[model samples]
Target: MDVDDYIGGGSGGGGEALIGMKTVEAPDDGSNCLICLDGGGGGGEKTTTEAWVETPCAHRFHSRCLESWAQVKLGTCPMCRRELTAAAAAATTTAGEDVHVLVADPMVADPLLARWNLFVQRSTDGSRSMSSLVRVLAVSHVLPDEVAAGGAWPPPPPHVVELSFLDNLQVSKAAIQRLFFYDGGSLPPFESVVRSLQSSLAAVLAVFLPLAGKLAYLPEPGDVVIDYSPDAVSPGVKFVEAEYSGSVDDMRRLASDDEHHTEAFLQLVPELEVSMLPAPLLAVQVTRPRDDHAGGGGGAVAVGVAIHHGVADGQSVWQFIKAWAAAARGGSPAGQGLVKLSRVAADVIKGQRTRTFLLRADQIRSLKRRISRRIAAGEPPRETASPVTAYVAIASLVWTSVVRAKPHDAADEAYLMVTADCRRRLRPPIDPGYFGNCVAACYARANVGTLRRGGGDNGGDDEGLARAAAAIGAAIREQLEDPLGGDIEGWLQFHLSLPAARLTAVGSSHRFMAYETDLGWGAPSRVELVSPFARELVMLLGAAGGGVQVSVSLDEAHMDAFETSWFQTAAGDVTV
Candidate 1:
């Protein structure tokens, strides 16, 4: 079905105005209700006297059954699990406005969360409120083992570092959300794991002090800086505890699937309260499967982290995780870390959904072989320094597939934005352990007709793949030569000027080795980015096995097209 049809307003085709519950006579067709498994005509038995309500998806359920379901399941169809209210709101949203509707089950409440909410109410005095399922605690800095031996009441003061131009560019972007899943077979109880993570996190915060600070705007100088003071209210990072009712296998299945479980994953991560300035820059959540009277000793545990984008990039975040893991294992958290700066850009579009595609090691090798043969034919290689690496091959394949999937004018142009790490490319090379943003954006453009014609070579079915790789490789070579070119301050505006429908942006990289992050129990079975900031963004990460995992976000119709085209052209006979 088309995306519009799936999310359309009502049975009568009226938009948002007509989206509400209305009772009507049951259908004459002898279909059983999904919720009760009885004929829709009545509750106890099939009768014509009962009334039913229909969801946007055209599924009918008895009014009483639907009312009970809504209290626990939120606004979704009982049969298909398709979002009703949220999807309708998204469909009716106007340009230049972003709408994020989250519905929680208010009927279920926890005692700990209730106390936290009361504390926040008295502290903020009506200034702010939080969700019920999330309970927050302030984690203060714990002195390292060596320092604590000397009995120091408090550590030295932290630095007041000014934000760079690159850092400011990300001020409006979404916080990075990543979740790590670990098996609980040989691990301690869930409560013990949480205590260990909190202590280790506090230790690591002492080393990376800026992360424990807030982004404060200076009125006099019109500048923003990392403001850290020893005696500030709620002075430490936000630590959260949550519970997921689903089993370990259920979450694993969702993680490995092609489509993203956005809402479920979002709940796993702690929400970064960014509505106010001087906001907490970091928050961490540890979630476990709800106990079913079975001992809670053997289920999956998920550790979710949310960090402000202005504070760090992908490499920096992983470094922090590794250090924290080391500290949790009773090792030193010390590392060669310093803040570095580089540019990034983001834009907003509505109605986007995320999907992941995996390319096996053999498939990657086959792609490289094909591109290598094409470059050897005197076809001026697309990549300058090293042509046809896994990144180039996979990125090009996605770029071409996306362009093919979407509708475009005959004279339209397609642009691909790729980010390159500038740690080693700078004049005075930045340290590999730098704990901040250090990346530059690169652009590649092609006429829609040329891309559609398989790079205008008409060579074979896979010629488009070769052409796309060349363009991406060449863009990397050119941009790396001068990482900071053009008007730096206009970076965000420059990206906004591009045609949104024909533009695609890539985030993260397979070189980050995300699967290696461990917290003493074992390395994570899977790691995923919750929700990308931009609608057209694509994220790349290293799979636990040997390959690249590519996450793409597009509208429903476009995503369907992309999947069909990608598997047919790129995977070909590969069994992945």
Candidate 2:
């Protein structure tokens, strides 16, 4: 920011520059001034107000330090960082309003004019082939001065909301990818970082104010409501800003195992077409892969979010993406210091394949001390006093290696199901930042001859891993006790008495650290489960070298017997 202090409010003898901004000399550098020490040096001859203002990554700058830093404050390039001119980042914006700057700039003659109705551009490069051109540039709506008064709006109340039993089942979308590395860092212009991410996402929808609301079905209390008005978040949060040419190691090969690389990150989040329902509970996409798309600027920037698993889970979407990345890295909109989980639902099968495995941390402390010494040596009226975590020893070794990778009927029954966290065991306690979906499910059956590995011929694989960690730690302590009586009518009668064949389900809960939801683009190198229809869903996550990543979901004929009965000589790190 130091181009000779850009002082021009009333320019004295040594300052005269901003008075009619003129300084042109852009045509492939020869280095006369590029902004300072001398385009007017002992080489003489330089007038028309010191000329030298070229950008759009052409470098040169001096018409008063590129019109005082790219026309008033950081459109960037104090010394060639490049980026400036989408009509100078849409001519001026400090607080007045509009700041849409979309630039694919093919020598600009229309990259997206006509108020940016759509401005798609994509290229993940394999010689320009990943091509993604999603464009819907602006559709504002961030409300929260508690809007509600166009004459006391329809006697309010009953915008109708309430759907517990873990937000009315049949699981909903919840993908939460977040990569943000600027490898050595320097990304100031993309319309000033999406206008400070649309004003810190309207200051975090005024503290998660019903996530800018929406999610309906109120037809005569047949239930399913979450309206919030302000025209149900006026379709806001669809704030997208994408551009990719490729390179952040080609956008980390789109977290591969290709399901069209997680359907190209579900088209970078924002597809709530639950096939319709006043849907779109929340959505956001901000990406920048770039290595070539005219003026390279790569290294990483991905912030995908898709919500509506009945409105939050995955610890309320990593506490609303770590409070919207601490309000987009400046701060405000916090308080929910993490910890929430359990919301399981399955049945969306179609080919199904989703792999990713790793369990470092001393193999999760040697599978929590061999399932806490087989649940403290079991016997009468429940044996095993304590210690057996890593989520009940990795959901009892992924439900006994997915029932030893398919082989049923020791007279049937396999079931695993699990998931727990009914907010401090229900009966009205909810505020661990009560975002939504309180979660609860338990069922823990087993009997394909005690889960198949060596078909229990008088147990001895440490008594079939402490009898599958005492049936998933007594079905997560009977669905977190405390009068959970009919824990939501026995988890909706154990998913309507599971007849979903061999049954399997364990859910996301690596102690909800979920790759530490660090929005500062430096933690998540991976954490994906793009739910392409949870075929026997598994997903765990916490590993990045520390321990635990599970993820599963088979059906390529039981992914080689569940990767040789859960990763033991099945050719490493596995990805499709």
Candidate 3:
């Protein structure tokens, strides 16, 4: 523990590398100082004046943290175990002065670092995901300090975020992951790698200050808001560093929802505090797999991210993760990875076409009135029918029209799958920024004969048109009243057993919050829901001019019918 034992007490003429010397980059993304994590914005000015260092591998670190780490191992890079080779020592050391010198060459190989596989290549190369055999090394909490907005830290606020109908049903946590591999090169020491990550996280906290807050319910009120006053007690995200002993191929096979994957990589999934309220808005794990022969010099590393449903919705999680990655890469989060969501059966949909249409807000108003007028003639459920909106009206029209156009056998059944946004229906409107799932769905069904808009089976009755709208209203009410949480296994099995063409499910929603993510990499190249576990899905997007863009997938036959009936000559479009 003596100073000389760690630093070098003897005369120092050893041409030693600068102990505190480093290369630094200005933080342009409003990230916290790499060292302090919450040093406030303006990385460019602070990094230069305060002094930062960039490793040969391109990671930036604080000069101070490096000095502290040097006490443990003076000659090797705290991150990658490379010997100090690049820049000359920054400290002014005179011959025979009592100064610690790192004289080792940075390029020299170190077996220990190599055995641990300490270095990771920073590239977005399209490859299989990293392995699942990760060994967790440590878990650290990154806190927030500074920034005028970081308010008081611990025991969040008293305001409760009443769970929307959709949120209550979606209590399930979303598990997402991104894998990175080491570009073919020598690895750095473990300290160097962890140091950069820890510091960069500090910078992120300064901007996204609320993330450090957890989910909790106060005594009598029993409500929830991201309760956090930024004092010492406030909590932040948990960062975990893990190592995998397997190869890239082994990882690809294990990262799915299949039974074989059964909690295999569960450790990668962050745990949330469930109770009065699910706590810890977010948790993350970085997994590094063993060396692989593929990619000349790189091995795989998988970054697992877990976000509590009460804390954030899927879109919000996407935004935060991308931001973190961009900060880590020393650039902005650019390039969206949504294009991979599409898995079209080209052969079946070969000649089919997809189109976008607009529906004016006023036109929807008129349609709503039309349905109400028809309902007035019959003994419709006033409670539900009276409250039906233009959205339900349009969905009814499309659903009935498509069924009429299809060639269904007597035994074949048709259904209109519709989802509702619970945000507006809540007693007291929840905050717009409130996270987590807030959607519920309803199914409106009718006999094939009653659904054909122009088929001879209808006998020219009005059963399919106006009546379908009423059924849609009833279904909406049904969804609201239906008790949640049935046998999930049965529910999943039922959907999977259904034929792809028989059911038309929504793919994406207008509320998906697209085009809002900018993780320093710029806009994503593509945004899409990769194919889901089941068949027959649709994607609904907000289109230009207050219209809704319907992205549907079907065989050539069904596409012809669905497209023809999607937009009638009556309604122009619907508000997204």
Instruction: Rank the models by lDDT, top first.
Output: 1, 2, 3
Which sections of candidate 1 miss by over 4 Å?
A: 1-158, 232-234, 292-297, 336-350, 378-386, 453-459, 489-493, 572-576
Off by over 4 Å in 3: 1-357, 362-384, 401-406, 422-433, 454-463, 482-501, 507-534, 555-557, 568-576
Worst 10 residues of 1 by lDDT: 8-17
Clash totals, every prediction? 0, 11, 62
Compose the digit string of candidate 1's lDDT tens values, residues 1-576. Answer: 223322323221111322344345665544444554344322223433445766656667665555444433345555565656634544543444322222223232222223333433333333224433323333333333323344443445544666665665455456788987777576567778777997887677667766777776444343456675543323567777666666667756655666777656666776666544565678888876654123245567778898887778787888788788888888878755323222231112346778877787877787777767766664444433256899888787788888889887646778899999887887777656666777888888777755665422224545556666777877898888877766652554355345556778998998877877777777777788874566578998887567887888888779888887777656553222
Taking all chains together, each candidate's TM-score versus the true structure is 0.70, 0.30, 0.40
Ranking by TM-score: 1, 3, 2
RMSD of each: 15.5, 23.3, 25.0
Residue 405, model 1: Cα distance from true site in angstroms: 1.1
Model 3, range 196-225, lDDT digits (tens) per residue?
Answer: 556656555554555565554333342333
> Which candidate model has the greater lDDT, 1 or 2?
1
Please give, for residues 1-576, the per-residue lDDT of candidate 2 as tens digits.
222222233321122222222234433222344432234322134422444554434445444434433322224454444334333332332333221221121111111111111211121212124344333344444444234223333324444456655564422333233333233244454556567767776667666656667666553433455676666755555666666545656666665433335445544554443434555567666666555233224355555666666667666777777777687777776655222222221222456666667767766676666555545656212444335676776777777777777756676777788678777777666566666666666777766675554322123344455567677777778667853566443343345445444677877678656666554434555666564434467877675556777777777677678767655422133333
Give the best candidate by lDDT.
1
